[model samples]
Structures are given as C-alpha cells and as structure tokens.
Target: MLRPFLMFASLAFFAFSAPVQTPPPSGAPAAAPAPAVPADAAQTPNPVKPTAESQARAKQIYGYDCALCHGEKGDGKGDVAADMKTPMGDFTSSATLKSMTDGELYYVILKGKGQMPPEEGRAKPAEIWNLVIYLRSMSKQ
Candidate 1:
C-alpha cells in the first residue's frame, strides 16, 4: 500500500513540475535598418578616366568578382541573383544609371548596399574606379 502511495505521489509531483510552454507574441521587432551613406562619401567623384586599358582590366575583375551576381552582361540577371534575398540593381537601364552619381556608385561598391557585399578589401581603389566606368558602359547598352 505504501509503495503504491509513494509512486502516485512521485507521478503527481512530476506532472505538476512539468514546464508550461507559452505561445510566442504575435508581433516581433523588425530588423535594424541599413546604415546611411555620408554626403561626402556619396559625392566623392571617380578620378579614374574611362580608357580602353582600364575598361579591359575592369571587365576582367568584374568577370571574376561581380559577374556571378551582376550578370555577365551587367543586366542584373546573374545566375545566383534568383537565389539571393536582396534585389539586384538593373545596370543596363539608363534611367537607373542616370539617377545615381559616380560617387554614389563608388560608395556603394566600397561599403556595400543592402545585400551586396563590400569590395573594399577585395578590390583596390583604382580597380573600383575602373568598375564604375564599366558600369557606365552597361547603361549605354
């Protein structure tokens, strides 16, 4: 009789001690916004001129680094673009290029924007300027 009573007490204690799971809140905080680019950084001009040699170098670099996501033709329809969470910029559109200045492009390339990774450490400043020229060519197409 005592053994049965002890077993019953143990079961009752375990049942009461079981953790209670509460439903999560309906609303959760949104993710933090991306950092804003400074006026000077956005206004900084590209010192490199668009020469054939520079453009060729830029093309090579872009093919190796940017073409995977920016597309081989710079149309923003790259192979991996569909799988990316962020929206890719359409470089082939004149309207899009017209709105953004060289400085803004430089800043974006250096610091990265939205889901784009920064090319600061990976690419030199001259190479980045060349890339800016290559991007300009994309708009003309």
Candidate 2:
C-alpha cells in the first residue's frame, strides 16, 4: 500500500540524514522511562549482536526519528523535547537503562508510548531490534 511505502521512504530518508543535537531546556529524571509492556515481551532477549553495521544503521534511524526528541547523544534533550516540555530519560546514564530489557525497548519503539510514534509500519522488526542494541550502546559512550 501507499501508506507502507511512504513510511519506508520517510524512514529511509531520515536514516540517511544527519542527526540534530540540541540540549533540552532542563534536565530530566535519571529514572527509567519504562512504559507499560506485557511480561512476555519484556522478558524477550535481544537476538542481534552489537556489530558495526547494525550500530551504524541504528544510529542513522535514531538520528532521524529519535534524535528529534531523544537527543543526538541520547541525553534525552532533543530540541523537540524542549519545545514540548517533555522529560525524556537520558540514555547516557546506566541507571536509566539498567532495568529495561531489549525487548521492552523494542516494544516501546514498535508500539510507541506517550508522544513517541510507533516504528511498526515504518521499520522491520530486525531494524527495531537493532535500534534496541544501539540504545544499549549509548551508556558505554
């Protein structure tokens, strides 16, 4: 369908573009932003290994879609978040991501929570999983 195609195209465009980094007006809590998810999904483990290719692709995708609100460095201080007055969790901190499994993160991306939009139609499950890996890698930096 055209809708699916459009979604893919837009996603591709964002993936190819550079990310914008802007600090949020204020700091957000170090608390985990774990949205509600089914236990089964939350327990799901990450299948994809952290690789240069996957991380690169995930970075690209995050740059376009997530960086707008989640920040370029995953500090949760993107320009959009500042304007929206959103308290996005900082991925740079270990505590923020410690309690969340890769599956839980994937669920949030696939289904979306709060103002976040689901990547369901726009990206394949593999890509979403890869994104989870990329998010986990943020704390290491």
Candidate 3:
C-alpha cells in the first residue's frame, strides 16, 4: 500500500514540476525603435575614400562577414536571410540608401541592430569606413 502511495505521489510531483508550455501572446507590443546614435558619432564622416583598392578590400571583408545575411550582391537575398525573423534591407535600392548617411551606416555597423551582431571589434575604424563606401556603391549599381 505504501509503495503504491509513493508512486502516485512521485507521479503527481513530476507532473506538476514539468514546465508549462504556453503559446505566445496574441497581441504583442510593438518593438521599440533603435537607440538614437550620438551626435558626435552620427556626424563623424567617413575619411576613407571610395577608391578601387578600398572597395576591393571592403568586398573581401563583406563577403566573409556580411554575405551570409546581406547576400553577395547586397540585394538582401542571402541564404541565411530566409531563416531570419526580420527581413534584411536591400542595399542595392536607391530609396533605402538615400535616407542613410555614411556616419549612420558606420554607427549601425559598429553597434548592430536587431538580429545583426556588433562588428565594432571585428573590424577597425578604417575598415568600417571602407565598408560604408562599399555599401554606398551598391546603390549606384
């Protein structure tokens, strides 16, 4: 009788101890906007010119770090983009590029946004400026 009682108690304890799975809320709050970039940071211009050599180096760096999500051509159609919850922006679009300043792009690259991880330490300041130049060129293509 005691054995049967202990088994029932154990079963009850296990059932209650198991984590309860709940579905996501039907109406979630809207996501907060990205934090504002500092005035000094935003105003800092890209000292690196968009030269052929700089672009070549930028292309190599972009392929290794950004191509996974931004696509080889910067069209926002990279292989991993399909799996991402948020859609990637097409750098090839003039409308998209027109609104963003070089400094803003640099800030985003350094700090990251949403699903993108920060590239601050991964690339030097000069390299990041080169990336900004490369990104600007994408809109012209």
lDDT of each: 0.81, 0.88, 0.84
Candidate 3 versus the native: TM-score? 0.74
What are the per-residue Cα lDDT tens digits for candidate 1 across 35-133? 577888778888987888889999999898888888898888788776653367788887777877888888888877655678999999999988988
Superposed by TM-score, candidate 3 places the C-alpha of residue 63 at a distance from the truth, in angstroms, of: 0.5
Clashing pairs in 1: none
Candidate 2 lDDT, 9-89, residue by residue in tens: 999999889687665445543434547899999999988777788779989999999999999999999999999787999
How many pairs of residues collide in each model?
0, 0, 0
lDDT of 3 by residue, 1-141 (tens): 999999999999999999996654634434445757888888888887677887899999999899889989999988878665447889999887787788889998888876677788999988899999898889898
Ranking by lDDT: 2, 3, 1
